[model samples]
Target: NECASPQKYHVDCDSNAVCVDTEEGYSCRCRPGFADISEAFNRLPGRKCVEAVNECLDTRLNQCSENAICEDAKEGYICTCRQGFVDASPNITHYPGRICNKPRKPDDDHQVSHQLDSCNPKDPRCGNNAICTDRKNKGQFICECAEKAFRFDDGSCRLSAACDVSNDCDKNAVCANVFDSYKCQCRPGYIDLSPDPETRPGRYCKELVNECATNAHDCSPFAECIDATDGYACVCTDGFSDTSSTAGLLPGRKCSNSSNECLDRSTHTCDDNADCIDTPDGYNCQCISGYVDVSSSANLPPGRVCTVQTTCPKQKTDLMFLIDGSGSIGSYVFKHEVLRFIKEFVELFDIGLDRTRVGLIQYSDQIRHEFDLNQYSDKSSLLHAIESTHYLTG
Candidate 1:
């Protein structure tokens, strides 16, 4: 009857316990697994003790927060701080605990290299010839043309270069473009037979001289000949083959023909107002005022006269000479010399073919008028007529 009472706390000697209102007779004993129900919080119910409740089994009734530690108790478990940081929320006897700690450690976003600064999408740090790339974990800057490509003056990359005369090639060689470099190509009649990387890296490159090409034969007989682009030439072809065999062409050993070794102008000994007159093996190039023939040849460059602005001489000559013509000029040289003299005279006067009058008189014992004074306009006609003279007698 006492054990059957309601609303009043009581227990039996058999270790059975109950809370009831009224009891026939009251008794104290253990409840469930308790050895002593009177002080179940710290003791056993009679000869029995309360079974331990697994607080960690079901997190709902006695839930332990992520920030706390759980410990088993007779009827529940408790939570506490784990490590590194303290729990910001206090413990609650009948509720779950709250978690509070320092901010979580920041993650490494730059998988490439975190030491570098963050990349900018607008003005990237990559160089002019490089590419700016932003990757998922990090950013990178790479050269666009690879390491082999050389940088240009404009901060761009070029596979080849603009070739000029100053490159490390023979005088007969020209500059050509190659991958990331410039190549020295032998002119038409020249080639590089060597297998040197500086010259003959490919089948088409060789170091050899071409002497039999067009215009190369235009050089006088006995003159050394060589090849040139668009043409070939006769000169001191060999650097060491001057007439004197000097370092280059010089006095006593000049770049000359069979006619006059002195005409071979390889040296210098003349005034600025004079012309070089050939002697034997060397020449003296008279540097005439207002004239420059660094490479003095019999054929002077068309003098840069006062053409843009004319300066006619104060003195003028209208008289002309007519010679006797027996037949024709005897030899080729004589004829050429005569014609050359005529050309020189005309060039000296800077005469216009339409401005002046010329006359021709060819006499072979009996006088013959080839042309009248008023018939020819300029010195060219007179020169031509004089050059056409034929000698019949001495």
Candidate 2:
């Protein structure tokens, strides 16, 4: 047989071509995955065979569905369903006109085919989140959201209460998703005047009332009004104390009494030349008669310094005594201790018009210029003026 011992008999053919022993001699035929360059199969001198083109590279050559994957084989090509898809054809092989459908879930009994025109009552096309209705008269089908709480989106149905990434609420409000719907609520430090604030629509939030600015707070006259979120705060003013039963200084709390700042050395900030005087509104620093106020502002702040008067009338030696007359200093102390000390100190200096003229100033909640240098000319009258000065007891 020429095919059994072709090499000894000088039988030759293409690598991909099979050698067959014919009645005359031998013949060459291309294999399944190759093509014959010369159509005729014979023991010709130059019979050639070449590998066939990959059918999977060209869509027209393969029978794979649009949603399926195509693979090339040595002999032909193969077709299989893609990921997340299923082969819906009755036969196991994927071929032309084959259907690749979405995988069915446990509760997809009511789903219908994706094609609206080819929908069947037995096999609905709508997804699980939707309902499909057959319109026989129109020869078509319709899909709609399953329930009232669902909304139609991008060819599907989703929860109506779902809030969009970009919140659909007012600028001053925040969007919140509830069980069956969404809600818009005002942020902190804001107020909504609508009767049904939670359910009201549109830009309901407005800036809360400024009680401190509008003077709507009931803070005491001796307290400072501080604006707060949705409310106001009352704090005791300087030199005043809150006598309320509660800890914090709330509205209507008593801040009437003046604090004895002079007695509390830690709180007092008076200059050596000035005396600290506790007042109803606050405290003050008064310069003595001999010294002149040289503070930056007209209203003396804390630590105000007083300097000796450089320009005083000629032939006048002004001597001033500043006394603390707050309630902390009792009446007995003022009349005996404070007054006696001043009288004895003045006795050392000559109290006369051209000599060392003396002046007395007492302060508590108010300042009292008892007698100036010009008012008292003699020692006897100046002594009488000092005795007549009564304790203010502020």
lDDT value, residue 17 of candidate 2: 76
Instruction: Give the best candidate by lDDT.
Output: 2
| lDDT by residue (tens digit), candidate 1, 1-394 | 5455533533434335443324445434446554332232222224334554576777765555565566554445545434332334443212323452432322445233223334465775645334444544455533333233344444454432223212465565544333334445444333454357453432244433233322224444445544443335455543223364443533222454335433444444344345666644544444455543322213543221212222332234343546544445545544555444544444445344344444556566578775665665555565666556554443
Residue range with the least summed lDDT across 10 consecutive positions in model 2: 37-46
lDDT of each: 0.43, 0.62
Q: What is the lDDT for 322 in model 2?
A: 90
Provide the global lDDT of candidate 2 against the true structure: 0.62
Residue 317 C-alpha lDDT in model 2:
71
